[model samples]
Target: MLYKELVELYKRLEKTTLKTLKTKFVSDFLKSVEKPELLEVIPYLILGKVFPDWDERELGIGEKLLIKAVSMATGINSEEIENSVRDTGDLGESIALALNKRKQKSFFSQPLTIERVYNTLVKIAEASGAGSQDRKLKYLANLFMDASPDEGKYLARTVLGIMRTGVAEGLLRDALADAFKVRVELVERAYMLTSDFGFVAKVAKLEGDEGLAKVKIQVGKPIKPMLAQMAANVREALVEMGGEAEFEIKYDGARVQVHKNGNKVLIYSRRLENVTKSIPEVVERVKEALKPEKVIVEGELVAVEETGRPRPFQYVLRRFRRKYNIEEMIEKIPLELNLFDILYVDGQNMIDTPFMERRKVLESVVNSNEWIKSAENLITKSPEEAEAFYHKALDLGHEGLMAKRLDSTYEPGNRGKKWLKIKPTMENLDLVVLGAEWGEGRRSGVLSSFLLGAYDPVKGDFVPVGKVGSGFTDEDLVEFTKMLKPLIKKEHGKEVELEPKVVIEVAYQEIQKSPKYESGFALRFPRYIALREDKGPEDADTVQRLAELYQFQERLKGGR
Candidate 1:
């Protein structure tokens, strides 16, 4: 397919708000592809991403770099391009305007295809070390030189990692299911197994439903981690789990999926980005401890003090995001592995195995040691026993307790009463920062006021909840400036639009219905607790979860 054809499709999808029609449009388009390789690029490009969500390599091109690229393409100055961006409040719109108003036409230009554009962007992402930015600039400038005004708009958005077209991952799943005439449930299951929509779509189109059913866990590929919903208290957690539950310590650290095939040990974070290079000690520990030659397990990587006490959660972030001097940093902030679940062992897939049986397998395959061992857990039918277990976890500087049903199967990416998180306090939401405003008074020149958003799983987008400016120390304000200033995509007056990558935990007194936000809800007296560096925007609280919390708050009010 041609790049212009895809851009035309984007324009059509933008004209309507109904998702059913949009999904149909994409479904019909998918049936017209001439090449199978295009299948892998089409889904991600439609979402304005250069790579899959799980891939770690990014375009690295930001607003200023894009300004330079646009200027070189249109013969406009950087100052003029920046001013146009300010006027339009969108970089894509500014690029469109600049391309349409170009003084000279390129006589050597030819139509760009989807493959050409996708390949060029991949090269831009892969370029590294000395003069790599220049390499990226030349490639982007060439794309702009050939793009139509409409194509230029999307190209700019694509480089920045957002399409702004209101398309979500769920819609793509629906379209893939419809395009191949496969059962939607089967398609969803295949997706959960691989975490890659392109591969699932290809298998469905080529081998049909039977092939999807045969989808098995691969040792190297990371599956989406199964999630847990919050419970009000110990009694509620116990009741939801059929009067008996396995309570495990929930450490305040990064969750990792460890894959071991022979001596090669790979670790992926909660968001599925590979982190094996940062934590070399984990690889060594896995090498020494595991008896099986091939297996995949889930665990927590917590930073520990010299006394073996767990460090604050932020200390773990440095190791996860490590880029340089890894050996030195590893010794300074040590980490311990806490295994919780097993998904596969040897040649067998264990995701469908009952929890108690899977635990037995997990224990049987491993040689427990100080560096690598199973998590501390308890099986109890009494509420008092569970409460005491929860208190013990909290007293040990852990987060809380995780309640898992003994007979349930692991459902990737599913959150419900099957697994519940029991914390000490009422509740705190893990939200993403959508935007931020410049600080006022003594805190001037920093981004202080944050606009918070919650994820809506059905719509596959973020909805505004409220803003928070209090509960931040002066040091926090300085750190915010360093982290958020480069992520500014657009600015108008005192407010700026961010890239929506930063996640933070928020404490709020109440939830109320309000028309001020897109979700028709707002948080009352919301304040910051801490930055969530281990989580991504997609892992934040969902709108459905917030509505449930709101109803619970109302019941408390009535009882009072």
Candidate 2:
């Protein structure tokens, strides 16, 4: 199909706000697609993506690189293109405007097709190492050379994946259901299993519901790992999970999905990126220990000290980042795997298997050893038993416990009440440093009085709670000064705004209502615990979270 035809669909989709109309627009487009191969990738393309999310290759095209390509195609100077981008906030429109001024087109340029555009992008992503930048630039320039001003608008967005398609996953799912006469639930389930809507669309288009039903787990492709909803404590978790729960230790390390297909093992991180080459030791451990020929298991991969206690979560992250001399790092920080859930075993689809039955399958298949074993767990209705297990996990250097419903099926990418995270909360909170003031008296040259803020995920910014100056040694003050100097955004006398990049755990006496900050809560007697290098600002405590924690504290006091 012509790329311009999809561009017209984008124009129409952008012009509507009604869901039914938008769904029909996408549904009609799907029906109009003639080739099955085009059907296979059009869904992804409509989402402004060259490949599925599970496919790890990025386009390797940045704003600067894209601007250079635009400049090359239109003979527009880089300066004017950048100014046009600043004037018009959209990257694609800026490139299109620049292309509109082209005096003439290339002699050999041809009209762009969806397949050609997609294939050229695949080549750009595949380009790497030693003149790869030049190659990627050439591929992009060649496409922009042929793209019309209208086609250039979408082409620019497609390469950078910033297209404003009205069709989201839900809309596309609905459209596929409408276009193919398949159940939405079936389409969704098939999407969850495959993680590729295009593939599911193709299957649904050709084979209908019967083919969708046959969509099952593939040993090598990483299924989205199940996530957990946060519970304040074990009591709340037990109450939420229906009084009796299959609780397991939640280690303070990386969660990995292990896929084994006889003599081969691949490990994926929580984000579903393949990390097989980073942790060969893990692959070796899985190959040696797992008895099943074809199976996929989910587990916590923790970096361990020599005494078998789990190290800090960041220790495992170091291994993940190391691209060179991995063998040395593997020995330097050995890892321990605690298998918790099994998704598939041999040829059987174990996702729909109940939680307790899946646990049994995991225990039955593994040759349990010290470093790699079934996670420590307890099945109980008693609060005392659950609390004891929670404390035991913390005592063993774990973060918390995961309370799972006994009969809950493993739902990929779903964080529902079927599974919950139980972690003990204190008056202390993890906060990001929003800004700081220069120290006075005995420490005159450092950012000592730190203005701290709690992360509000909804706002996507930090909301101030209070300022802390107490809990740091002189050495810490100097080190923090050195660290924060580079991230200063603005300065006014001794006070300076920061980029909210640094996270620290702050202890407080109580959370009190106040109008001093935007969050309307203040931490009394706030003191620093330590820099939380393992966490980012996104991982910091939330404003609503603090409000909820304060309410919980109030309820406990009222009961007393």
Candidate 3:
């Protein structure tokens, strides 16, 4: 597939909002995609070569390369290319302009197909030179060589670490569903079950769209959670809900989902990345806590303080830092797995069942020992009572409460109102941790500040919206380094790619527009609250909401 073909498809998908129409459009195109390489490139074209979890990165392509490429394509002087690219903050646009000036007509035209795109991606993903620098450069060069003009443009942006693909996971899911002639829910189900788009395509081919719908929850499939924020106190949450809700004390700990299959135990973070190796001690605790032959239990891993009370998220993070001496660290900062929701037991997929029934089954399967215990929860009809419970949680030094709807099915990765969060003033908006800068001065050894973002529904990607650096202690900084070190994938300019699993509450003075951050926004005086163990990436506030908040703040300022 030529780069132009992919761009044309992207252009079409970009215009449509309806999923049904999107599916039809995609299916129509898929019928013609005979090339296998095109199939492979679709993932990289849409998603990118690196998985969301990688964090470590090198500097992006230098200006020198941009100038050379621009000159080669346009017959322009290096100085001209440098000035244009630097002023625009976009190397791709510079290349595009140069190419256009050189030729009045299209120089290369080819149709995009599954085969061509897929082959290009395979090359990009597998490109590795002798050293790390060589590997990165080779990857960039292969991308330019294989991708069409448009593909090369975007591919260059990705290599430069500029992910300006406004389309988001939800929007992309809709597009995939449209392209495959399946329902959005079905496509999402297949994605959650397999986490493989290629697998999804195959299933869509064999069983058709409905086959995608029949995807069942299996032992190894980790479902995303329906997340909520805490309403002031539990009392406020009750008041807001007008008396109908269930309240559970939010634990200050590492969130974990333990899948026990007889003797084998696999633990995954909320983002569905396998973290079995990171928490060896937690694995042992789950083993002793549950006797189930096969089960998936979702819960928190809280670090107990000296007073036997669970400490903040920092303590739990410390246990992950070490590759060696893990046994001693596990003994030192031993964690308690606080089970809350259960999705499966034995061989049955219980997610389709109501919460009440699932909770009963969860209670029956696990022994409520201190190290591996069920989290406390209360069902109430009165908002007043729920609010009172909220107070009790904060008074106990716990984060507010997680109020879940009793009748709603667990819709993985969707933020339905079924699950509402109520937190203290300290816990405000959950900002996606975008990029972390090296700590300065006293905190020179670790990451101290994080560039954060909110989801932009229209763009379909997280938009840089804020930053938080004030609330964490030195202890928290050290702990975060241990936890965040491995999740790094690519580093470009001031941005990064991290597994969207970790969500943190941040308090900001205000929001403002800025050119420095790709998000075109910035936060004023932001501080940390807590690690949101209950919230998923999809649950984070949208960019639209952030814009609204900013506008509202402006209104207040004008009134004052």
Candidate 4:
């Protein structure tokens, strides 16, 4: 197949913001492809990649390198390309413009094939040390020289790893289901377990539902962690959990998934990034605490003070960011592993197992130690007991309590009423950062005052909430600037438009009715709690949820 075909499909998908049209375009394109190998490769191409998320391979091309490559391909100077990029606020558009102005072409150039393009990009990513940057630039320039203006635009964007085509995972799942005539649930389950949609698409295309059913939880593969909904109070949590629930202390630490295969142990973060290198101490302790030769358990890794009390969440996060003198960092900030749920053990997939059974299995396998122990939990039918647990957790410098139904299954990536979190003060909402304003004074050059939004399922778009300029430290502002730089879409004086991708936990005092925001509601005194790296924009709180919270707040005020 021609790479131009895929480029045309991307153009079609970009023309419409309607999700159904986009999904249909993808489904139609997938259905037209006949080769099983190509079927496997198409999903990755649609996602603007040739490697899986867990592969740890990057294109390693920076903006400066991309500018140089485009300059070489089109014979345009680097300054001209840079100026165009600045004017358009997009590298892809700038590349396209430059390619259109090319005066000469190779005497013998082949039309870029999909296979050739994918292979070339893979070679670019696999390029390593010692003049690899020059080699990568050569490959990119050759591809651009052969590509048309539209193709060059996509090629540059894909190489930079910032394809803002708005094609998310949900759309891919729907497209796969429609193309293969399989159930969306099966595709989602396979994806959640494998974390590879390309594999899921190939299996479903070749063997259909039976192949999807054969996909099982593996020891090394990181499964998506189960998420929780928020509850108004302990009574509501207990009521939602069918009266009898297990209340566990919610620790304010990083969520980790530990996989033990024989003597080797690996730890994955909630975002499924391998943290086995960062938290070696936790891995060693997990191996010592769990008796199973092969097992997968989920827990929280907390940094503790010298007196064994938990440190702040921000302090614990420094361990993840540390790249040098890891042993010294570990000794300075020791970590504790608090096991809560087990998903696999000894060749058995335990995701379908009940919460009570999973908890029992986790307890039986884990030997209590000072650095590694099970979560402090209690089975309670009374809301008072749960409330007491919540307070006890807070008094211990932890988050609140998580109330989970005893009979609930461990549904990966699902945030439902089966598990609910109850915390003190106002409830927190996971919102998406839509845009941000340029800072002034001390933060003059950095992006600050984020424009927040909530998901609107009905419109399949993000509805604006309000802007927040509080709860961020100097370090946070710097980190956020680095993170949001690549996502900037357009600059409009003080505020810059962005692709809504970053999810953040925002704490607000109350919800209020407002016509100022597009969501028809605004948060009162909204403040950023933390960046929720585990979640995507798709997992953000819905506008309906905001309305419900507003109504609940009104009721509470009336009762008071």
| Model 1 misplacement above 4 A | 101-107, 129-131, 444-446, 457-461, 474-502, 512-521, 551-560
lDDT of 2 at 486: 45
The CA lDDT of each predicted structure is 0.86, 0.84, 0.64, 0.86
Q: Clashes in each model (backbone N, CA, C under 3 Å)?
A: 0, 0, 45, 0
lDDT of 2 by residue, 288-371 (tens): 899999999999999999888889776877787677899999889999999999999989999999999999999999998877
How do the predictions measure up, each by TM-score?
0.90, 0.75, 0.65, 0.91
Over 1-560, each residue of candidate 3 has an lDDT whose tens digit, in order, gives 44565566555664775545554555565555665434433544555333332111233345465445445444567687667665554566665555555432324634444355445434545555557445544444433433445655555554444444434456556656666567767888777655556556666656777788777666655666556533334554555555566678888776777788887888876656566776887787788788689998899878886677778777766664455787787778877788889888887888788887888888898877767888888889876677677788888778778887676677766655567666644335777776787766898868788878787665545667766888898898898876665445455654445544467888877677788766667777888977764455656777666665566456446642
Query: Which one is best on TM-score?
Result: 4
Sort the predicted structures by TM-score, highest score first: 4, 1, 2, 3
Candidate 1 CA-lDDT value: 0.86
For model 1 the TM-score comes to 0.90
Alpha carbon deviation, residue 518, candidate 2 (Å): 16
Give the 10-residue window scoring lowest on summed lDDT in candidate 4. 551-560
Off by over 4 Å in 4: 103-108, 129-135, 382-384, 439-445, 473-479, 551-560
Which pairs of residues collide in candidate 4?
none
lDDT of 4 by residue, 175-265 (tens): 9999999999999999899788878999989989999989988788788878887777889888888889999998988888888999999
How well does candidate 4 score on lDDT at residue 77? 93
- CA error at residue 132 for candidate 4, angstroms: 4.2
